[model samples]
Target: MALAPEPGPDWSAALSHLVLGAVSLHAAVRSAPASRGAAAGFLLQALAATCTLAPGLGTREDCPSGAWVATVIGLPLLAFDFHWVNGDRSSANLMLGAGMALAVAGEHLGPEGCSVAGQAVLLVVAVTIAIVAVFTANTYGVWGGALLGAAGLLSRLDEDGLPLRRGDACRWALAAGSWAYCRALRTQRLQWE
Candidate 1:
């Protein structure tokens, strides 16, 4: 017997996960010192995720909107990480902002039949941004960036003629990444203070 088709996105499940992530991150940021920039970064990431999970919006147009939300949230989070690493706020913010801009451009051009290489290049750029973010930002930023990066790669895999299995794998990877980050952050806080 053939395997059954996978169900379409379950908006309710997505929304539930988004809410839990947002709330947990919000609390974590609140506990951190204001100088750490964790609060701002967490808030932005939560907003981006929530926007992406919004109901009744699943189309190419919705994707760009989601990408814009991700860009807005990701840029500053990346900058905070850079500042944490190099103590150069201005330069770090500028670089991250540029990356976000590129990500937005990729989202816009992707559905329009960009070449496979083009899509791959865009994903590489996004992953580079995430790598920088992981080192500079806190655990939350690290995990969120990783999830986003994985999602980007999985999306490219689908674009490049991979099976739907790749997309399913991407979804699971994203969920795992987010949950792991949240758990790690909580544990770190418990241990540190």
Candidate 2:
């Protein structure tokens, strides 16, 4: 007999990520001079969204390997997310990258390594990075770090046998919408600048 799928919350949040990612992609395409960095961010967001949306082969219960990998890849890319809108702060991007990498590393450490402690550290670092982005007025990056950071911690719920829930959808939605917003806003500003 075939195995049954796990029961969980309806895919409202998961579906939201899919739509937001499409809109983000569209916005990125519209912004002609947007940095290659922004393109990378949009693509990563789409990948993560797709992974969560799938019910495909090798897809894990209430989540998939693809989703997990895509989400990880997005960590560093997020540092690049608001580049177009904020006109690029090379240093801020660098710090954001390093911070996210640290946070992700912390997750793998487990209880002995203080996995939860590491996650908390990440949340703090993420906020700090976003604040720096805000200080320089990197609107999208600010949004990117803030939302993605929350998303990062929330994905933890999917670890072990925890069922996928609103948290899963929320993080992806936060990421996709933030990217799309930054892209659209930047494109509009570029026309006037």
Candidate 3:
């Protein structure tokens, strides 16, 4: 049998991801040239979105459970964006990327596994990023990181008993975050240029 298309939210989340990617790529071009890696950064974000939404695309059916794995893909995208904004791959980028990976890894683990580990990781990363965002006043980084984390967990809200399925909440969150993030990046690029 063919795989049924994922419902509206999944597609919408995917669409948001694509829009963010496109907007970022445009910002890079508008800034100046390809040297900034803006294209690469956005491409990575798009890749993360594709991976999250289409994990089971090549399989017999798309396994919705695998969608949370999008967090893993998000780590590299975060690192890339930081590099673009900072103009170099600083140690801070590496640390933040590792934290992102850990945070997502925790999401993948449940009570049946090592749940505490994951939550701790998520907390550390989230708090650290928020603090750094404030200290440095990197609005783009703050928005992107916050939204990326939100996308990772919020996508899993598809359980029963909730007012909205996790997927739907994730869609709206991703859509809003992606727009804000892209706007921040665009503004930053314009300022730099």
What TM-score, computed on C-alpha atoms, does each candidate reach?
Answer: 0.48, 0.55, 0.51
Query: Over 4 Å off in model 2, which ranges?
Result: 1-9, 27-32, 52-58, 61-65, 81-129, 138-145, 152-164, 172-193
Task: List, residue by residue over 71-178, the lDDT tens digit for candidate 2.
Answer: 444434544444434555674466456545754674575544544543454465357547646676656646656665765566465555544564555555465545
Off by over 4 Å in 3: 1-38, 44-57, 60-70, 87-89, 92-132, 136-141, 152-162, 190-193
For lDDT, the strongest prediction is 2
TM-score of 3: 0.51
Candidate with the greatest TM-score versus the true structure: 2
What's the ranking of the predictions by TM-score, best on top?
2, 3, 1
| CA RMSD, predictions in order | 7.1, 6.1, 6.4
Of 1 and 3, the candidate ranking higher by lDDT:
1
Which scores better on TM-score, 2 or 3?
A: 2
lDDT per residue for candidate 3 within 118-148, as digits (tens), equals 3343334444444445555768657755875
What lDDT does model 3 reach?
A: 0.49
lDDT for each residue of candidate 1 in 35-108, tens digit (9 for 90 to 100): 25444544544554555465565664664455354444443453444344445667566655655565556655
Comparison by lDDT, 2 against 3, better one: 2
